[model samples]
Target: MNTTQLERIHSGKGFIAALDQSGGSTPKALQQYGIQEDRYSNADQMFEMVHEMRTRIIKSPAFDSEYILGAILFENTMDRTIDGQFTADYLWDKKGIVPFLKVDQGLAELDNGVQLMKPIPGLDELLKRAVERHIFGTKMRSVIKEANPAGIRQVVEQQFELGKQIAAMGLVPIIEPEVDIYSADKAASEKLLKDELIRQLASLDQDVKIMLKLSIPTETNFYSDLMQDPHVIRVVALSGGYSQAEANEKLAQHQGLIASFSRALSQGLTFQQSEDEFNTMLAKSIHDIYEASIQ
Candidate 1:
């Protein structure tokens, strides 16, 4: 990759906004506005509503790309047309925001109490589709709700293995291994995850580079060394059920780590708000997250 391209993928200047709620998470998001799943009747109907939400964001006065480096999209969002332009094209051409796709199928239970994404059966084909649509990268998630050495090791291996495949296809991968904030052993979980992550990355070829989307650490600056690693292109954080205020506080403590939050990024934003009110809240959230990101 060119030096400029590397910077575009790795720079610590901006944050990513995650809008890629799969089918499993979308209905709950709609329910927050009192729209029930039964009203949709079909998956396409549901997707249309999500597309409208995306349209609102793109058309908002505060939807500048300055604070937002990129937006992650569900597969449908990747293909859907917005104002006669494909969603990915619209984001890049109009907002200058890079587009990424969520490639993982939702999580599946592991015997050890962790969750891993279901197998993505046609990932290479999906990568070809992403390339055709001009998507810049992909994001997949695995969750560690408790501390288990065996489970953490599995998550690290799968994420890096998949990440290498993504990079080989000429797109960056954001390997998100999120630790649930509610866990009693959050600190120990982070340590185990980080140790496994370092081991996995060290095993890969030296030229390989990938991004990490982690939960905010219980220990301040716990991820500093990972952020500085040669193999880590960038380190981004998930809200992982944290409130916007708490997420910002934790994120601000770690340098070179930025936010790629979903719920926190959209907290207080809803269809019920007036356009002006919606814009104001969204802008403030972006500003606050941005400040934490670059601090």
Candidate 2:
């Protein structure tokens, strides 16, 4: 990332809008909202619908970029043109919304029942393309299902390795080690995650600043110190299938960890509403999340 782009992301407004759901996630999200899968048989068709949904929000009169520092983009939508302007250019030029690309392919099952994002071949080439497109950063994800120390360690190690590579490419990486919200050992898992993060950070170069997207904790202020680490540019929380209200409540407790939510951020929005109603609903949602974020 260029210095101006880095400053744009690390600025005091720390919220990130996670609209980067991949082909695997997009179809399901559309179905949940009553958009029939029969109507969109392929990924490109689904992306068109998804882009329409995102376009509505970004083009809304009440849309406020101040509530979000950046937006994470799906592979197809990253540079696709909408209204004769590239999506990234539209967001930045029109609303000052920084663009971040989601570089990970979908996840694959890993050892010990864990899941890791499929390793991208030629990721260096991809990051170069993102830079050429003027994208500011990248996000990659992995999932932790149990409190198994070994499994967590593997995830931490791999994520940091990849994060360091991203930093070397001059792009900030958002390392997302998402804990299962349904886990019986949520608190225990968080402790393991914290320990693993600290262990990994010790080995990372001090100048390689990165961001994190963690599952919101049930306990209040569990990651305060971790968020304050100098290597951690920003710490943001994922809703991890929680409802908007529940996510907001949990997010409020973590002082510096702001929202990078997907489902929670779009919870009340729908295709049935009029454009005016849609904008009003989204504006309210953004305001509520922003309030929780800055708390």
Candidate 3:
């Protein structure tokens, strides 16, 4: 939800997954690509996998410090529920790296658990504090199946309240209207979607900066004009985890960093033994992309 931190990642669009699995000294990243494949294995024997991953990197004999160039918090999965602010704290403490969080994919269950853990703890304070910055959320469907204006009103009202909660806290809530593969009525579809976005933003009544954040739009033209505006920066989120092909496509076109939730571990790596192995592999792919561009 921290917007400025997200902006910082454009320097290197990196891959991210659960931190619990990705800490190790082994260059599994290089090895996974057959550069050093013999050196890799799953860390199935470890008790504290995430901690182990962290230990490996922080104590690496190669790197002088834990100053990784790029880091992604796999906002998918329950890692955050056990520690919502943990990743945030890690990023805050770890300078020289752009730390980004990918939410909306696997946040539902984790969010629910947090609510139950501290329900009604500080609604007003959270809302007010959130207004000063961009608090991004993944895709949220704020539509009514019923065609009645009345039904739309009810749904819109909910979005407005939530938007207000975000805006009041000094944060801009990024209400993304998704147009994934199966969506029909491209133009009309997006219009409807953006309309809902605005309805909620309007209800916030100028308390926060309202930018229309979205995944890859149906066509770039859908947001071609808006992309130039300083207040509007797009997220080039490519799902299906990560692939060299998809990474290349994003690297060629996007002025912003590419996002991945599931794709990091889902593709490319031949051998996988543990979560740390998986995470290191994902980070390596992203880092390689960064390196390729730098040279």
Of 1 and 3, the candidate ranking higher by TM-score: 1
* Model 3 weakest 10-residue run by lDDT: 109-118
lDDT comparing candidate 3 with the true structure? 0.38
- Model 2: how far is 223 from its true place, Å? 1.3
**230-270: candidate 3 lDDT, tens digit per residue:** 43434334332235555445444544433433234324544
Error of 1 at 285 (Å): 1.3
Off by over 4 Å in 1: 1-5
Ranking of predictions according to lDDT: 1, 2, 3
Q: Distance (Å) between predicted and true CA of 243, model 2?
A: 0.5
TM-score of 3: 0.49
Pairs clashing in candidate 2? 1-170
Stretches of candidate 2 off by over 4 Å are: none
Q: Write one digit per residue (lDDT tens) for candidate 2, span 143-256.
A: 988888888888888889999999998889999999999988878888999999998888888788898899988678888888778888788899999899888888888788
lDDT for every model?
0.85, 0.83, 0.38
Error of 3 at 219 (Å): 1.4
- True lDDT of residue 179, candidate 1: 92
